[model samples]
Target chain A: MDLKDKLVSSFMAFEDGIDVNDPVHDIRSEAIKNFETKGFPSKKEEAWKYTSLNNLQKIDFSVFPKQESALEYKDIKKYFLHEIDTYKIVFVDGIYSSYLSETTHDGVDVCLMSSALTKPMYRQIIELYFNKIAKKEDSLTSLNTAFSKEGAYIYIPKNKAPRKPIQILHLATGNEASLMLQPRNLIIAEENAEVQVIERHQSLTSNEVFTNSVTEIFAAKDARVDYYKLQNDNANASLIDNTYIDQKDNSVVRVHTFSFGGKLTRNNLNYYQNGERIDSTLKGITILDGKQHVDHYTLVHHAQPNCESHQDYKGIYDGSSTGVFNGKILVDKIAQKTDAFQQNNNVLISDKATLNTKPQLEIFADDVKCSHGCTIGQLDEDALFYLQSRGIPKKEAGALLMYAFANNVLESVRIPELKARVNKLIANKLGVRLGFEL
Target chain B: MLKINDLHAGIEGKKILKGINLEVKPGEVHAIMGPNGSGKSTLASVIAGKEEFEIKKGNIELDGEDIEEMAPEERSHNGIFLSFQYPVEIPGVSVTNFIKTAINESRKAQGLEDMPANEMLKKIREKAELLEIDRKFLSRSLNEGFSGGEKKRNEIFQMAMLEPKLAILDETDSGLDIDALRIVANGVNKLRGSDNAIIVITHYQRLLDYIVPDFVHVLHDGKIVKSGGKELALELEEKGYDWVKQETVA
Candidate 1:
């Protein structure tokens, strides 16, 4: 049978240990039916024109890991931002690893979705925001919803802030030869609350693993949220990430994605300004080589007046790798005095590499300000020669030029440690130690 | 210290520097003045080993060694420097860091390790002081938002740090004010030594009053039609290029 058919037939067996009569189970059943009907998106779809999931869907991916696996901290220490203390929610082979996790309930909720979904005390929050903001028609999100029983669930109360940042790490061990994972995350910040989160997905072995993950964020009045996604998976891994954010009045939310290593990655990031004077910022840096592929599809909806959204994405493609970026902005008739700006810049270091960038703006308000700029080209020859003329070799000159090209996006990264880590990664990706201490 | 023999060069199949011959010895300053499109910049670029220009015939030699086959950085390591007219702006790299990298790279080519940190810092401080540049300016991005004067001063600052054997100033006086030009010429004078050579390429005689060339050559239609003492620059300023064009054609 096909992967979708197998998943549908195995749905009942997946619920052997859970309460089948719970209200969340009905939602799961409905989501599975939606997946069965929609199957996988094809290239004919406008949003999927530059990316294709045909090859991924043909492989017979097992819906669940065969068994639970254990990992040592030393083996995967390089994957985490261990330079600073953080509340960690780690999973191994789709099972929560208590040995590797550090949960807390001191002033907020930093726990598992399973506990929040099943326990009686957290039912009110689960009912109000389980899947409220996620688009219902997205089949991949539905696929994640069908199996969203085990992921990170973070809740910050009003007027409170976490002592440190939170890390959500999912490790895929090739115990089942070929595995598929669906990890769901929900983060809600009450009025005047503030939080920072870092998420990453890693595959430990040379086995095929495809993950469909969904995340929903809600920032209430005067709240602040900073989310970072670190994607540097192994060669055999592929990922599709769907993130939806809802912002209220006087709130600020920023999401930064750094994509360096992966066979294929697709990011669907959506932001909705539901209240006046809201601020939304989206930024990303992608450096790919060796036949890797990454696509970023972003959307910003200005529904209220006097809102603002800013987006900037930079990419460097080498070898035969391909990249895509499509930014869409929508301004309603009432969203006057809105300010939205988007910029996408890319460099193809090799002749065989390809990149496609498009900016779509649908503005209804006459008085709003919406501007976008996109550029795809190689490193400036004049700039390269300038550096070389100063005694730097050609290769190092090109590397320095590229590093300078992608430097501005790093300015908005609030966490200093994370910024330093990304700087090192950029240097390493260019295959240079540089003169400074990278 | 530098020799160009019947050199023919061009870019994209269009010949610019046609049948040019010149020589300069150590401690001597040579000035090449020409009208627009007279191939002065092309000649400088070809001497510095810019690959975009094609040398159709002849060759360039430095200190009795043929250098037409070497790359630009190799030529730089051999102590050849060409200060550009319009400097490229690199947004993230600081001026101090850029010069440090350039100095270390040249040293590494000579089978030496990277310069010690303290020594590098001291050298940078001295150079900045010599150019009268502020400490904060050293940390800013290279030439990103610099004024015309600031950019010229930065080029001179880099030249001071590199200390090349053969320095080619390509239009160093193109967009400088009088005060800025005097400061730049003053800095260049301090760096001139009997062990190195300088080639000043300009269109006007304003800069020569400050730096004072040993020999002046007027280029018309890709060839130096006349060579004379420092009075030649004053003659060109007074009589204009029309006089030189009529003399060359006659």
Candidate 2:
């Protein structure tokens, strides 16, 4: 058999060993069938033109293995965790680790996707909403759905707002040469409920790994959810992350993604303002050096009248790295009075660096206010000279100005813990300490 | 404290400061008056070591050190300052943070340790009050949404914070109202000492009335055509730039 057929056979064999009667198992089977029909996308695909997943098809990724080493919190705390007070939920190799998780809030329910799937209510919700928002044409979405085993499920009841944020830590550790981890998260904020969720993925081993994660967020009427995803995998790691968000009437959803470390990273964010008076804001910052390649694709769909969406994605490419931003805003005919704005700005710090930015808007409504713009340039010479004239050395001044450029998006994060974590990530990516006084 | 000998500079291959000569000893305040495109700002920028301006021929001396080829930061470390006519608006960087960075950088360049936080905050508050600037302005982004007068005052506040030996005010009074001009001039005068010098570059004599210059030079067609006492500003203000142009032609 060819490689494609052999891969499909392997996946089918793996699925037969696990229980298939559960709802999640049933969904997995359907997803695998979907993936078998649509294998890895190539450069010919419109969306996948700038970002090629051809490298992923060449590797034979192994399923997650049983735990072989003891998980330590000290390294996690020293590198990824901070002092911010929050409800911490830790997952090792995609499985929920109870000993590493803690929560003090009473109004919220945080549980493993496995446990939540057992409950009829959560299972019904997941069955109805899971894998429903991301487009079916996306091969990565199908791949994530087919390989989903361990995940986190957070549910905030109606009229409840948690005081502290919910921190989700995904730690990848194993002796395998190439480990493939699929972390799935479903967050449902009921009507008028508010919550802050922070999802951080880090690698505990130096082995080459690939993390495929899919997160779905649902904000009900009048509910507000602030979500932050920090991807700081090991230098040798690669990740494909897909996040889908849906908003109801008068709901607000904000997603901030920070890409700091990875050899090859691709993030797809799909936001749907499906109800009137709903609003969504998507912001991302990608700092890449070395041969790292980062691609961000965002789609903001205004499906209802009077809905609003804004997208701002910026990148700082250094060394021989490459960054890509493809953002699209779609305003349907019925979505009149829609207000959407999208902007992608990039800075090339090295001569060998490259950036590809495309901002697209498709508005069918006559009364809509839609605008999109993209800028790719180097650092502002005047600002640099201003800083240098104040006695700051050239390098420190450049670093400070770059940090200030990133602070525009970083300051918008409402959750303090996630903000601090993102700041550290940015510092590390720039090869500078967090508190470089000079 | 500062001297410029036959300075010739330009931007993008076009000459601006042609054979300009000037000298300012400690405790002296000199004014450079010029018409449009006469390169008043160019001279200040060149003195501050801005790289955009190419100096074809000239020598700039600060405290007996040749600074013609030095970078802007090196010039700043040697006690040179320029109060930019149009200060940049840096979003997401607070005024306090910018000033602290400037102070720390200047100190470190001078072989001094970074100042303690308490002491730095106290000094900033004192300077802010002296310039009639609200303490809250320190927390705002650096000149992000500042008004014309506020930007000028912020420049003076930075001048006070840095305490350079030679402070070049390049059209610092252009966008300021009379009251703001008075406050900025007062800040400059208060910071002036026997060990420092000031260069006021302006077109009108309004700012000169508040902070009187000891000497005034008329710059026309990229060259200084006339030099006189502070009264020369009033004469130029009365007759306009045409008089200076006519004199240069004669």
DockQ of each two-chain model? 0.76, 0.60
- Residues A262-309 of candidate 1: C-alpha lDDT, one tens digit per residue: 898999999999999999999999999998999999999999999999
lDDT of 1 by residue, B34-96 (tens): 888888888888998888999999889999999998989999999999889989998888998
Number of clashing residue pairs in every model?
A: 0, 0
Candidate 2, residue B8: lDDT: 95
Q: Which pairs of residues collide in candidate 2?
A: none
TM-score of each: 0.97, 0.96
For candidate 1, what's the TM-score of chain A, rounded to 2 decimals? 0.98
Instruction: Tell me the native contact fraction for each prediction.
Output: 0.72, 0.66
Where does candidate 1 chain A have its weakest 10-residue lDDT segment?
A429-438
Tell how far residue A330 is off in model 2, in angstroms. Answer: 1.7
Model 2 DockQ (Cα-based): 0.60
Worst 10 residues of 2 chain A by lDDT: A429-438
Number of the top TM-score candidate: 1
Top model by lDDT, which number? 1
